[model samples]
Target chain A: MKFTCDTKELSRACNTVSRAAATKASIPALEGIKIDIKGKEVRLCGYNLELGITTMLESKGDSEEDGSVVLDAKMLCNIVKKLPNALTTIQADKKSTVTIKSGDSEFQLVYIPADKFPELPKIDEKSAISIPQAVFKEMIQQTIFAVADDAAKPIYTGALFKVEDGGLTMVGVDGYRLAKCHESIDYHGQPFDCVVPKKALLEISSLLDESGDKAVDISIGLRHAAFMIGNYEIFTRLLEGEFLDYEGAIPKSHATEIKVDVRTLVESVNRVALVVSEHLRSPIKMHVGNGQIGLSCATSIGAASDTLDANISGDDLLIGFNHKYLSDALRNAGCDEVRLQLNGPLSPMVVLPNSGDSFVFLVLPVRLKAG
Target chain B: MKFTCDTKELSRACNTVSRAAATKASIPALEGIKIDIKGKEVRLCGYNLELGITTMLESKGDSEEDGSVVLDAKMLCNIVKKLPNALTTIQADKKSTVTIKSGDSEFQLVYIPADKFPELPKIDEKSAISIPQAVFKEMIQQTIFAVADDAAKPIYTGALFKVEDGGLTMVGVDGYRLAKCHESIDYHGQPFDCVVPKKALLEISSLLDESGDKAVDISIGLRHAAFMIGNYEIFTRLLEGEFLDYEGAIPKSHATEIKVDVRTLVESVNRVALVVSEHLRSPIKMHVGNGQIGLSCATSIGAASDTLDANISGDDLLIGFNHKYLSDALRNAGCDEVRLQLNGPLSPMVVLPNSGDSFVFLVLPVRLKAG
Candidate 1:
């Protein structure tokens, strides 16, 4: 394979696809990026069986022939990035030795035969949905943090995407907390739901453009899903299992409600958490009063207490919670103020926007020991 | 103990001393910072037996009594940094429980008795020298990288400071390479030599102001060294051993000399080193000719080569060196151009300034295998 391309473009493409390359694999070819040259077009692909990323760019120089080779992913990326910002040429000879030249520097590396590389799984475009890239990115960022990393239940490792009644809702739930976000879209097909692995969603989010209204087309297939963003295509396997009924698990009513500034509450929680270390895994205790919420934590090392003014309209109550869960929800609320709803000391606390119902975060409370 | 102080000043003082606090120590008090209050003066100290750092600041509030307490170093720094930028008051009750309050936040922590903290070693000022903080900082930065980290030979783990003939020289040498820097100082004191631990030099370097010509007083004693900068005092135990005779090891003559741009050579060396990883510990080979130097490296993974123009005088030669040692000296040369003198393929290569003799860097050659 012989082709010349801009060094910056090649470096970016290599970086974009290398996220899916297997770091350690039984198949040696799976740890490499396959480069294919046909006339003036060049395509680079990286795959690790479960996920694959492919990108294409036009070469700046004339190609000697149409051929392909697989090079080590990490080495290729590093070499291209460090090369001077000029036109770079890559050529592979019949002996399976590739030569890369730019400016006054040259590198010769042994390449794996292209025939040994595994092909990406074929994705059938059964149902397609198009949404603004920024909107989709926000939805993922707001909900993906609650996904469980445990492997015992595969479904909880991914976020559930549900499309119904011209609305798209994404839900991520671990055993301790649940995060859900919704956005309106123009759709007329039958309702559908699918679970996408967290890894794929994070990569897609990073590649999305936040300012422009560019659209990303997502197509769900029988066992795989494909996401098309500009000239790049990402394919990921659909996680197989039944997801939890998050709506049924969340509390429907609350006996106590408190309206408070999100930033104030988040800062108070962070301060209290300073004394809670790995050795002292203490829970933060909140005592809700008539006009303020007192946040405190006591461990063998130290004790910290903070107070924030809140508009409360229910019976006073005391609750205990894992500081990390509470802080995560407040930080992701993406609003100035929020309403916290509590049914009892042991029930889950629901957090919602002060005026709208676009997002809902539920955190299960930890039971406190008797004094 | 009771006093109020500016939060920013308190935080900065805590951070300044916490560097010497031990992360894990057999003595519990060594992991904490000692705070002593007398009248309106507040002093903070952190010592780990080998090194000690102390700083003093004036408190804002009137003191009720004079007392001292030791608080956890990490917790104190974190709390002060995160607290609101306002006046903060700290008070310890009769039960040795300390309460820290600022704005609407309060923290209560148990403190260790100040009597348990170890005292800093006394330094009898037998000889003293003062130099500009900026110049001293630069001298340390240029030579400290060559200090050996191996504990087997404790002498090589510190830098040798020699004061003689109205000049001060700092030398750092490992088995592979040596770095020496010299500066003329206005001093009339007995000539002396001492080895300061690399940890102490690093901390002193960081605390020195870079833009001013302010002087830092350094006193060398029989068993300890003291560095006084502004209101902070740092005391460190001297390493007792015979240092290497660096001047005798450096070559006085060379068969070949080449003048080259420091930036260009550094860039080329960096590019070639990319292919030499931990698994492929290959040395870079340089071939000098009439007007240019060619650098190349080959391992099982790949081969890279580059050429740079230079002014060569004397016989043509070939040499090999570990890329890391070569690059470190070149990058810290602090000049645009450098002169490289080589005796033969097996002798040490000396890197000198193009115009002056203020600095010298020597790197030993690695023997290459015969083809």
Candidate 2:
């Protein structure tokens, strides 16, 4: 295989695909990136059992023969990144030795036959939906943090994506918190629901463009899902299990509501949480009354108290919460002002936009010991 | 004790002293910063058994009483860093509760009485010598990287500071490489030699001013060394042992010499070293002939080669070296062009400035296996 391309372009493509490469596996070929050269096109692919990423780039140098080889993903990426920013040529001989040269530097590495690489699962494109890259990225970022990392319940490790008519809603729920975001897309297919692994969504989010001018096509199959980016394609196995009924779990009624600036409340909570050490798991208390929220936390080492102004319209209430969960929700609210709904000290607090239903965040309060 | 000071100034002082605070110690007071409130001057001190740092800042608010307390260094630094950027007041009540307030945020932390904090050693200033902060800082940086991290010989872990005839020479030597830096200062004190711990020199270097106008007063006592910079004072125990005879170890003549651009040689060595993995322990070989140096490295995984232009004189030589040692010496040369002097394959390669003796870096060659 003989191909020449811009050193930076090759480096970027290697980085993108290597994210899916297995670091340690029984099969050695799973840790390699397969490079296939044909005419003027070169395709690079990296795949573990659960996820695969592939990208194609045009070569500038002419090739006398077409061939394929698998090289160690990490070494190839590092070598390319360090090479001088110039045109680089890579040629593989029949002896299973690959020579890479750029400027005055050259590297020769051993490679494995591409036939040893595992084949990626075929993606059915019957159920495909296109959404703007910016919107999709936002949807993933707002909900992915709530996914449970524990493997005890495998279903909770993935986010649920539900599409109906022209609207798509993504929900992530651990035991203590739930985050949901909805966006409208131009879709005219049967409604479907699928669970995407958190790892896949995170990788997809990083590859998405935030300019809002480009769109990504997503296809959901029976057992696999594929996301088609501009010049790259990411494929992953769909999670198989029953997901939480997030719609029914959300509280619909509230006894008290307060509107507060998101930044102000986030800062206050962060200061109060400083006293709550990891070894001593203490909850931050919030007293909402007289148009202000008094936040306080006392631990063995120290005690902190902060107050923030808010617009209140109902009975005063007192609540306790795990500061991290509350902080995450407020930061992800993505609005200037947020409305917080509380039923009582034991009920889950709901965070909503001041006017719209674009996003919803619910955090369960911690039970505080009586003073 | 009560005082008000600029939040930023107090935070900076805390960070400076906290570097000497013990992370985990049997004496809890050693992990805390002692704050002494007297009139309008507030002093903060952090001392482990081996090293201590103290700095003073001016307070704006009047105090009703003067006292001292020791607070947890990490917690105080974090709280001060997060507090609003305004005048911050700290007050300690008779109950041993310290209250810190800034804007609307308040933190009450339990403190230990200052009497429990260790006392720092007093240094006699009769043998004090002054040097420009920028010059001393450079001298430390040029040699510190060569200090041996292995604690087999405690003396080798510290740099030897030799002062005679208004000249200060700092030398750091491990078994394989040696780095020496010297500067001319305006001092007439008695000649003295002492070894300062690497940890202390690093902290002192960071606190030194980069601008050449400022000067730091350094006093060397029988067992302790002190550095006074602006409003901060740093004290450290002097390491006691016989040091390497660095001057006698350096060779006076060479059979071959070459002049090359520092940056070019550094980049070539870095690229060649990429193939030398940690587990493989391969040495990079330099073949000097035909007015260019050919660098190459081959390991079990792969091979890399690069060629750089140089001005060669005398006999052509082939030398092998550990890439890291070579890279460090070349980077610390601190010059646009460096002269390399070589005697033979087994002899140490000395790197020096093109003109003067401001710095000298010597790296021993690694013996190569027969081809």
- Score every model by TM-score: 0.98, 0.98
Worst 10 residues of 1 chain B by lDDT: B57-66
DockQ of each: 0.87, 0.82
Candidate 2: residue A277 lDDT (0-100): 83
The sequence of per-residue lDDT tens digits that candidate 2 reaches over residues A30-79 is 99899998899899999998999999999988653589999999899989
For model 1, report the TM-score of its A chain. 0.97
Say which candidate scores most in DockQ: 1
Kindly report which residue pairs in candidate 2 clash with one another. none
Error of 1 at A335 (Å): 1.8
**B109-215 in candidate 2: lDDT tens per residue?**
99999899998888765477889898888898899999888667899989999988879999999889999999998777688899999999989999999885799
Per-residue lDDT tens digits for candidate 1, residues A1-371, read 79999999999999999888999999989999999999999999999998899999898996556899999999999999888648999999999799999988999999999999997888786688899998998888789888887757989999999988698999999889999999998877989899999998988988888889999999999889999999999999999899999889889999999999999899999998899999999999999986999999999988999988999988788999999999999998888999999987999999999988888999999899999
Over the stretch B164-205, how does candidate 1's per-residue lDDT look in tens digits?
978999999989999999999987778899999999999999
Looking at model 2, residue B352 earns an lDDT score of: 93
